[model samples]
Target: MNDSKLECLLIRIDNFSINRTEILLCIHFEISTQTMLSQSNLNLPGITQNVSKVLTIYTGGTIGMTLNENGVLAPVPGQFEPRIREDMNFHDPTYLPQEPEWLVLPSLGDEKRVLYKIKEYDPLLDSSNMERSDWKRIAQDINDEYKNYDGFVVLHGTDTLAFTSSALSFMLQNLGKPVMVTGSQIPIYQTRSDGKDNFVASLIVAGTYDIPEVCVVFNHKLLRGNRTVKVNCEALDAFNSPNYPPLATMGVSINLNEIYINRPPLIEPFSVQLSMDANVSLLRITPGMTLNQISGALSASVRGVVLQSFGAGNIPSNRDDLLTELKAAIARGVIIVNCTQCLGGSVADAYDASSEIFEMGVIFLGDITMEAAYTKLSYVLSKHAWSLQDKKDMMKTSLRGELTVKSAKLNTANRLGNVIVMEKILIQNSSVVNSAIEEAISFDQTKVIELLLKHGAQLTRPPLEVAESLCAAAARGSVKRLQSYQTAGVDLSLPDSSGRTALHMAALHNSVDVVKFLLNHVDDINQRDILGLTPLEYALRNQSTEVIMILNQAAKS
Candidate 1:
């Protein structure tokens, strides 16, 4: 093909709307497919290979808006795509002319090309106008195209972006793909807009990585959607995950903090839960909050309330009327959750003023953002089939990495006060008793383990994991920790996930004291593992003569 003809075809593809019919017309040109593919002066070699598809859900945001006649910025539909297409940073016109549905982007040295299609919303809304209905719509759209795309990016206004992101985090259950929410404080049309970078980075991360989380990608940080809060109105980095770490950081390279990312559930199928009950409210407590004001905040129609309490979840303990109104709300089955008004720190019953509220059944979520608490309440309350207690329990737990769960037993251990008081607290929080027992045993806190056991906390976890815990204790030569578990009725002969007994770990780690202790408790001193190796053999292989001597003597006996 002639250079002029090739140039003509490239310009035609660039000018036209990306659709299949237009692509077919390009293919009908007299040149061969190979000839068309060879004309590449765009610095990308093999641009068609290693492609990832994303569905960009352009719900109206500051990024897509242009200034109106009144000089105020407003979202204008059908304007975003044209602007980005004109900017070569977002679209590469030379990529696969016969397949125009894929809006190809230039490779970012990661050897992956992102081909995206914009699904802009009609009658675009400022995120201030977004509600539960909007969250449901976005979630449902992602669900509908879940199979067709590698990931999703929702462009939204930064005003209520965190709330929308939080709602989507709950509504989109068992999400196995990245769903990134991002927007700019500045509009894309402006000369100094941050939208271009935010938009491009979101696309790259959503397409390139397997971070199975609902993330908010803005200002070079990928934050957990539910964990985020709009911290600053004027700054480019508007959102912050104060309690949690960002999932990925966009910089010289797209660096992912793999440990913080959620592993996609293998058992549960991806689902969209549209039934979010929006009849939830927030009550930020002040010093002089009257009974009538409290009652109005916890309205009759509201099913749940996120009480933004003072530092460390405190309330005016002297105000009997205030306490009475809160008690009345809880009595009527209102799921009241206590979240701190401070930017950082958890809502704890550390103060005397916080005690009455806790006794009255206000669930304390540690360091959870107000946006997350409110949306979580809505999500939990929407479950019509769940019992009242079950819904309340769900709120207390970190379902979507929303809160840092400070266990009741751990809290009690941190403040080792009167046994009677500790027992009362632990007894009431039975749901986390087993977990607390494990934590205590791991730390070799014998007294805490005993306290939990007295309250019916048992080693009732999955048998394989329990075995591993015992083996880990044995390997560390923590006789006290092992003794606590054994005294709590744990079978000393329990095998780990690898089918190796605690004796195997103790022998391999050269723990002579642990070896001696296990010899008296385990069913057999010479038990064979799944690999057909006995503890004596493991000790001999590891060349631990003391453990070897102990095993040899035990074998003789």
Candidate 2:
């Protein structure tokens, strides 16, 4: 069958509650060709786009609220878009003739123009009231409209914004497009509110960048969604990613820290996992806390617990009863994840007091926030098909970049001159080699690359796809990295499956320095792609004047 028919079949299968044999029989008989044809012909969105279109899921938040009759800031549904229409910063009238309801934003200095439509929820929630069902609804909506939009923006309330972001990060798996969650401390209806800036920046980032991860864009900083926590209540900058670095910092120019951003998964198709087990709770250990409190938190219904331990994952030594209760819970199959109570730092056995807890089978999650820990446990435990041991193993793994694995060793090596630990990690897992190479290439870490090469780690070469290659990555504005590839004996003239070389990618991104560097190495400046376009043609299409000049000078030379 065709790609569209196969996609329709998957959707139909997902809608049914049938047995495996029945599903196989249905597929064998091809019983639904008429149904598939009708579904496929319903004006489904195609895969190509020239302009960016974003779907803003406006769930009720402080940004969309106004004073009700009681003079309290309450969410007023169906009123947000009208306010946006009045604000020139959000809506442009020039594109109204094309789509009356869709709001368009004028292109801002080299960024793609954004045309957005808002999907407002009925009886909008005050984020404090958001639940797991709400998270499932949002994830499902994004999946339902996945093909139509280039990216997504979720307008949420600051009260539980971190929880929502963390939940969505796990729900949306193998995401290829940007999904940005944003909110403001003040309402957009007010004159001096930060909502306008937050909302506008979110649309711009979602439209312009191909950041495949879920992110939170607040106060001009783009942070990974699962790593964020609300640090302040009244400040414009309310959220902070304490453990991870900002993906991009917005200033006079929006500077992207591309090394920290995750590339899309080249193998798996995008999917949404909406099943979340809500039978999880967080328990923070305090001084003089009784054993009954601990036992009460991990009651019969609770299947998982995120234990907030003392410094370095310690517990009170005198409380053997508390230990007994926790051990009993573990024996009863409760997954307990130990996290640090401090604002920063990982849960480790550095302290002698933490040794006993470590022996009790408590999983240590390094530097993960409480929000992430809770949601991760929920997501993991909800996998009913997986065995108990699988759930425990997954909690220790960094699936969505929520926690750092082996953080202590890496930090110690960086702080001190300890190369042995780093070398061991690199040797044990070849996957670390690719991440190491990416970092080295992006930051010009020559010594690090040399170390990896000395350890017998193979350098990644260009394959059929452009994104799969190091040269294409370098062409996005890293001349030093491109030189490193050339010095390492990599062939710079190899074209991707599309017959586009690094020079073509450099021309499209307007990387003048990269274009100049590749001119000396490439055999032909006039080499044409599968579309019969040269590097100069790509530069001309993007209006890249500097690259065009460099290519023209090279062509004549």
Candidate 3:
């Protein structure tokens, strides 16, 4: 091809207004060129081989919005694609060859080159206006192009991004490829915009990783779609998952939490269910909330209600009207799920204040985010074939990893045996062991310690003396055992023999959960050990990136 003809081909390839049919032809040309190059003996330098194609579905969000003549930011139809194509950050000048026949991105690490095409929606939507129909459209698009692309990206607005993400997670059943939902707090047209970074990172993650579930990518964090919530409207870091940890954190490199990413079922064919019941309501209870207010929320037409109740799902125990209203709602075939209003905690029936609500058949949401509860309830209720009881059962069961199962009750007989062993050990060495109970507690043998206390084992030692056991439990990464020790009145600030606190031990062992628990209970995070190393230093020494993040956040808090 002559220079002018080659330039025309490059311009056509870079044109974002072209339809999907034209993009497919460009892809075919690249494939044909690869075949011809392989058949001949010629080898091309700096040209990436084995490209991975990703489908970028621009559904309109803050990432694509620009300032109009009125100076208010709004979604400008047909603008996002062309902007990305012309941006230097996205289309590196070094990667654009003299011939410019194909568009290719730099390899993620040393993996296959990522090639992508944009499919913009006819009319862009602000995320606040996103509904079930829009979610179904996005899901259907992915389903139609499932086998043709390695992964997919959905550009969305941050306002209702979590809802869309959660809806898609349920809609895309048996998915075996990454589907990333991302948007920016600022428009890509702005000088200080976060759109380019979030967009590029989501593309790399979708094209590189084999994560087989819907996810939200924002502020350099990859979170499960159903678990995510929009926590901030103004900050750059806008979304968070309170109950669940992030699946990955992007820094100098993309650090993936492989253990948390869900794997697809073997031999299952991909499918999409676009239907969702829109009659669900989320009622957040406040101080002086009235029965009439609650009753109005659970109206006859509402199919499901996600009640964001007080701590541990407590309602107005003094108000019989509230209990009556909840019972009546359940009787009328309305599913009421009790989720905690607190940022982190589970809704349990352990408290007397919550007993009446539980007795009225209010289902415990068990540390699930409000986003997950609302979306899951809608998804479950959409099945017309399911009975009322079936819908309730599905809400309690985790279809995705949205909620965690409560821990099993401890075995009583085994506890008795452990208590006996501990009692003998305490009796055998009463004088030499200054704090036998403390030693037992440090090892996280809570059952033995509990039994010893029941049998009148002495716990008369000073609180500081029990610090060794706290450190031991932290090292073991036992949140429950650590809580038991904390409840037994151990001084969280006391240092062990080596002058290391529980925080240090948790950080050194890379126990992120334990470290988070200690941060709330511990007196000082900067307290150094014998070597003058704080918890942050220990985290760095052990190369625990997650622990380091926890400590840094705790320090800021």
lDDT of each: 0.81, 0.79, 0.76
- Model 2 pairs in collision: none
Tens digits of per-residue lDDT for model 2, 37-97: 2221323233122457799999989999899999999987689988888778898776555
Question: What TM-score, to 2 decimals, does candidate 1 have?
Answer: 0.69
Model 3 sits at a Cα RMSD from the real structure of: 18.4
- lDDT minimum window of 10 residues, candidate 1: 32-41
lDDT for model 1: 0.81
Q: What C-alpha lDDT does candidate 3 achieve relative to the native structure?
A: 0.76
Q: Which candidate gets the maximum TM-score versus the true structure?
A: 2
Provide the lDDT at 310 for model 1.
Answer: 93
What is the C-alpha lDDT profile of model 1 across 247-352, one tens digit per residue? 8888888787754665431214578899989788888999786777888888899899999999989988998988887899899999999999998878898889
Clashes of each: 0, 0, 1
Residues 238-311 of candidate 3: C-alpha lDDT, one tens digit per residue: 99988777999999988987546665312245788878999999888887887678888889999999999999
lDDT (C-alpha) at residue 459 in model 1: 79
Ranking the candidates on lDDT from highest down gives: 1, 2, 3
Better of 1 and 3 by TM-score: 1
